[model samples]
Target: MIRRKDTRRMAKRPTKPTKSVEPRRAGRGPSPEKTAQTRRVIIDAALGEFLENGYADTTMDGVARRAGVAKGTSYRYFPAKEALFEAVVREKIAGALIDADPANRRPDEPVSTFIRRTMLVSIREIERNGRAAIARLVLVEGARFPEMTEIYRRAMFEPLLKQIRDLAATARARGELRRPELEDYPHLLIAPIWFAIIHNGLLDRAHPLDIGDLFEAHLDLVFDA
Candidate 1:
């Protein structure tokens, strides 16, 4: 006897749905604030390296290490050590020049008074703000690295000297200065500042002369104020 085959079809089981995943986008670049912060850190690190090791000894690797950044990061911001040094001077030292700009002088303000208010204030903060250290670095390494010296001279010295000359002419015109000698020898006004810097930094650190006071005394002699 042949058995009749069952004609009923079995129901199929349901399969679990698969989860969809989106492809990740390429990593984004650093934000502007982060980039600026990194640049600032590199500059500060470079200054420290220059001050501690001198320009000849400072290296991009050392600066990057000091900054706690990858070597490539520092190089990305400054292609070479010379560029790093220039950045240091521009950020740390050149800003002080703004205070000494003759254009900042108010109308009818005596040149001596303007100097007292502006340059004097900057001088007082030099040692405290690390400018004195940078100046010493330039003095010590200038001969070997003339390019560094030129950077400093162009960024600071030339502009400052021109400002002094202009102010000297203004002082004489205003009768704040009685002699035209200052117009000829404007360095006379700033000689004491250099003396104080050298004295305090090199000659006799044990007996540091207050640069601000020394500069003010020189002002009195030059302007007879």
Candidate 2:
């Protein structure tokens, strides 16, 4: 049920943070809705630049050009290029965090069913959000942008890890899982999703593996009775 659209507004950060742009000097430059929309356009365009050119090559000018706005306008919305990168990565982190929320699952759902659906939500996010490009960007530039990596880990990865840990705890309490180790090692439950991402994103030319099949086998292996 977790779709891509639900991810953008997940965080309530103010969209119009810097001084008003577009020369609306009489104070309130643009309507709140318009300001938010412009900020989103900038974020999307910056994502394109970052995805295509990588971190080092992407520039504020490129993002502004892609967004069809003046470079000053882009800077008005985002104080620096790193701010744009933060915006680009924020949506992905939000999507992952939203998918990890246990409330999204149906009440009293079977553990296996809930787990499958949860993983599928993430899969859909990846497929819909060009996650492959972002993954590559992070892998290539993560050492330089430790803050970005920290943002992603704290906002998305750690939360999702907690969710899986919670699920494992519940299953263990209910005697559904014979493997108490799952509670201690919930990372094992989600490893295959990354493996699938690597296959599809990095090397699908020669070793194309169906993601659905990979997840199914992951579940069977983990939920072994």
Candidate 3:
């Protein structure tokens, strides 16, 4: 019953200090969504700058200004004007190529029919979606900027032409195509598209040609349908 004798029980032990946790800061780099958004903004700005000023006059600084991003930001996405132009072609123009790719054709679908469904639809919307403007830009500035021309050709032209050649072979094998000319001249399939693009854009701005109609008419003649 001598409770006062027990000094160990009488004295309260000191409590240990709890460790403080530091608040987590977000990562310094941009998130994936933010990065994609930034890239889209830069690409849109670059396209507008290239269209307004032409490739020769369009500068990375100008594109950044248009994008409202720091010049370095654009450089991070696109190292040079050529690279930016390539991106524009790949993103904006090359997408249509997928629609017309021969690989997407049904086993029984005629080449002409497949093109009418795919390439024709894309051609119909080309002007509405600003693709015609990009094509016009390439046409107007391609000579002055061979690098830009090469980028367009490599990204949009070659792949599409190759697809056309493949389709031509398939058509001939299936008896849908009567001539070997398409295989030799894949450009024939797209000739009307270029002509319509040129005629509507430059030759007759007052009386624009319907690219879809022109391409459809060309198809009729080529397929003899």
TM-score of each: 0.84, 0.78, 0.84
lDDT for each residue of candidate 1 in 54-134, tens digit (9 for 90 to 100): 888899999999999999999999999888888888889988888888899999888888998999999999888888888
Which candidate's lDDT is highest? Answer: 3
The candidates, ranked best first by TM-score, are 3, 1, 2
Off by over 4 Å in 3: 1-27
lDDT of each: 0.88, 0.76, 0.90
- For 81-130, candidate 2 gives per-residue lDDT tens digits of 77777777777445666755667767777677887776665665564576
| RMSD in Å for all candidates | 8.6, 20.7, 7.3
Candidate number with greatest TM-score: 3
Cα deviation of 166, candidate 2, in Å: 1.4
Q: How accurate is candidate 3 locally (lDDT)?
A: 0.90
- Worst 10-residue lDDT window for candidate 2 reads 92-101
* Candidate 1 regions with alpha-carbon error over 4 angstroms: 1-28
> How many backbone clashes does every candidate have?
0, 0, 0
Model 2: residue 99 alpha-carbon error in angstroms: 3.4
